[model samples]
Target: MKMNHGFSWQYDEFKQVGTDYGSKAEVEIYDSSHADFRDMEAESIRILDSLEIKRSNVLIDFGSGTGTFAIQAARRCARVYAVDVSRAMIDRAEAKAIKAGTSNIEFHHAGFLTYEHNDSPVDAVVTTFAFHHLPDFWKGIALKRVNSMLKPGGQLYIHDVILEETNAVENIAALIDKLATAGGKLLREDTERHFRDEYSTYDWVMDGLLSRSGFTIKSKHIEGGVLGTYICTKN
Candidate 1:
């Protein structure tokens, strides 16, 4: 087993590269006519479908990563606020919206756990592969903030990559990912700047956050592996 070297390299050598990878990936899609969001487009569609975002309500995507979720969700939601910590990611997301001629989406560059705005209430808060990178306390605080940010009966869904339910050929799949991304757009950086957040975080913290925040743990959908999607609604 070669291990998830691509993920490991990201966790150990290109800090904040998760945000960077997302931003650059959109650049790839924008520059090439035949460029697709790859499998992510399908994955986003599937996940949002599971979330069931309402067309009459507002939805906010936390750490929205180039607006993949935001864009798909706009069809059903009145507006989609795409929030990200990196300006580069926010910029790419805006570019994609313009290219698509969509007017229902907006981009905001803001940290995941540090967003201070609570004025524009949203009906749902969605995050994927982002919460898995925070420690327990931060995850809890984030859920609390999100819960407080939503309108009554508002929904919150956190999707992540877990280690246990990962597919058997995960290592091989990762190797393929490495080869496919090789030189395509590597986040050239030293170890101190890698995806350290994910390497240092886990999913149980999120589960605990839901419990402690008094969020109604409604459902769990394991999509990619043992690490799947968890739906928790605030009461």
Candidate 2:
């Protein structure tokens, strides 16, 4: 994938947002810290199965942290293009892919607004916990770009921190408390920083973005009013 230079007013997706994934130290402890809350392997398997990924399909994974989901997807698919903005994260992910002996996965140090997919349209595009880096306007633009990268009726799976309009504040606090209980101080502070600084928007806004950007939402699920998952198909 090539990197596209946008207009001067365009959002700088490569810039470090709320979380400094550019830090090598942060990259090192990412999996361990997230493991306390998320089962990456199991989540990857579940998502792959839900998407009906096949041996002959090609897919793109945006914000492919540490290559966990990319490696798992490569095992079941023909090829996986794993992309990230942070060079540190990409380095770690590439190293993990090599260690796992997965050669079908390609690592690209790019982000939502800059990554230019030149190959034939892919079967699916998956992004997890990364879309919030972009503000809502740029998010809509990014989704349009993602739509162009996919084949007709291609799938898109997005999992991120999204909020419900009602009880948004209380839900976020409860979610933070839950993370703190599960992963201690590190998780608590992390969650706080995410909501405090990131661009997580209401569910209605996300739905509007997807729909107006050329997708039909197949399924939308929100857990505990903080995490959102959407399975959509290109229209």
The most accurate candidate by lDDT is: 2
Q: Which residue pairs clash in candidate 1? A: 14-193, 14-194, 15-193, 15-194, 55-76, 162-227, 165-226
Q: For residues 90-209, could you state the per-residue lDDT of candidate 1 as single tens digits? A: 787788788877899877766555566555767788887566555555566567778877877777887765433334357325533543454244322211132333432334555676
Q: Which stretches of candidate 2 lie above 4 Å from their native place?
A: 1-6
lDDT of each: 0.63, 0.93
**Candidate 2 TM-score over all chains jointly:** 0.97
Tens digits of lDDT, candidate 2, 135-235: 99999989999999999999999999999988999999999999999999999999999998989999999999999999999999999998999999999
Model 1 stretches with alpha carbons more than 4 Å out: 1-38, 165-202, 223-226
Please report how far candidate 1 places residue 68 from its true position, in Å: 1.6
Minimal lDDT window, size 10, model 2: 1-10
lDDT of 1 at 87: 69
RMSD of 1: 8.6
- Residue 225 shift from truth in candidate 1, angstroms: 5.1
